[model samples]
Target: MTKPTFDLQSHSLHSDGVLAPAEVVANAAAAGVQLLALSDHDTVDGVGEAIAAGARHGVAIVPSTEISAVDGSYEDLHVLGYGIDHRDPALAERLRAARADRELRAERMAQKLNELGFAVDDAPLAARRAAGKPIGRPHLAQAVLIHPDNAERLEREGHDDVSSFIPAYLIPGTPGYLARTHPTVFEAIDWIHEAGGLAIWAHPFWDIDADAEVLGAIDRFAAAGLDGVEVFYPTHDAAQTKLLADRCAALGLLTTGSSDYHGPEHRLFRTFLAHELHGYAPDLSKLEQAAARAAEAAA
Candidate 1:
């Protein structure tokens, strides 16, 4: 089992990755990633920068994004849209609305954290609002816990390190929880399809419900025209990966895998595995198939 020459799922400042879009392209080029996709969260804002850098670095940059959507049953489902026309008016509107909601949620969470005695100022929150990406809990974490310039002060004040801070204190339903609304998965698929892109269900293993529950959602989404299932996700260990692969096969759906890289934000799962990790190495052929389909559709 050798590593794939390219990886499709990744991020940059366009979303929550640690590096800028150019840096991400440069790093991937240096790492020998032949093809790269900067699937930032809800935004294709970095595509131009990534494409320009990829040209210089000798890598192919695919325009993509990870959209959070609610399914028919109102469950949160993430759809990875590839080869999207980022300038689509409807798509841009939705992304901007999502960003606005994120800012509101972040402000509410910050206020709540202040109530909890975390000395976190509104400045970091404000800056994130200005940056224009979704200011979710992770941004809050960067604001309050992980900003390296404040690391010593945070440690002296007894703050948990960056990793633990999110899970321990700021997860959904915690004291500072602020829920943000997202379009339904069906709506997302519709938008992506309308924009002439491909939408695939992301990380089946992370589905909150059991396999049957998630399958039920997938079944309904199939009618709305979902392109594939992410059977090969970074979080899916070997057994889970194989299970999803088999399921997608039986359903006659394309199967795919990716590193889900977010640079420093998720450094652990930043590259494609040559062999199985907990049992998954996505077949990149599906990605190529998706590309072909998108091209045909565009034509």
Candidate 2:
């Protein structure tokens, strides 16, 4: 298979990703990705470093962020903002506030875990905060896995990694579950537009919500000025990809593809390049044009 030229969604240590920004860019270069975006959750703090690495590696980096948002009852929906001004002061402040919320949520999850008799270490969380890494459920899971008090129970339960712990404890209706508080999808789209970026729904099928609910939410988001949808993803089957692509065409919305690579350590899905996009030949022209316009506006 031909290597993909564009991988527009990824993460770095600024969020929950295992790799640093420069490391992620280096890997993208090695994978023959010509265009990339460091769309860290709720933060663009890694974009500057990734851009520098992209320059050195002859890759074009899009300043981007993946914002956690809600659509009606769907609380964990994400919106990817591309061609953003990473240095925008107002955007930075808003993201900082979002990260603060994440921290609070993490603390509450930790408390919940403790109430359930799972002692999670606070030191690791403090270290992550000191390093400016965003607190997330994965971090909490990792803490649980490492804490001496939970080791026996986790081992007996076959909970060996972060992923195993998440569904068992962190998700809604679980013992450590904490409902997220976030802006509406419309508000998130407006935030992206205000930052001179295009807001695209990220990995619609990846959400726990049903496909019909996702479709309905996307319709609502498109009507609210959402710029596009992530049509190609590792988890999307051929039918799902075709469905999203057709929907985007019908709605006059741009369609984009990405690996959503977190790093080698993430076990959820294998990294895919644009060429691996399921059942569809990617046409990134609309996305590129929109990104160009956003960049120009930011400039």
By lDDT, the best candidate is 2
Candidate 2 C-alpha lDDT tens digits along 7-64: 8899888888888899999998988887788899999888878877877787777889
Q: State each model's CA lDDT, in order.
A: 0.69, 0.82
* Worst 10-residue lDDT window, candidate 2: 290-299
Which pairs clash inside model 2?
none
Give the clashing residue pairs of candidate 1, or none: 70-185, 237-278, 238-278, 238-279
Residue 81 lDDT (model 2): 92
The alpha-carbon deviation from the true structure for residue 50 of candidate 2, after best TM-score superposition, in angstroms, is 0.7
Q: How accurate locally is residue 14 in candidate 2, as Cα lDDT from 0 to 100? A: 83
Model 2 / residue 243 / CA error / Å: 0.5
In the range 44-86, model 1's lDDT, one tens digit per residue, is 7887777778777877766678887765444346888877776
Show where candidate 2 strays beyond 4 Å: 1-3, 269-275, 286-299
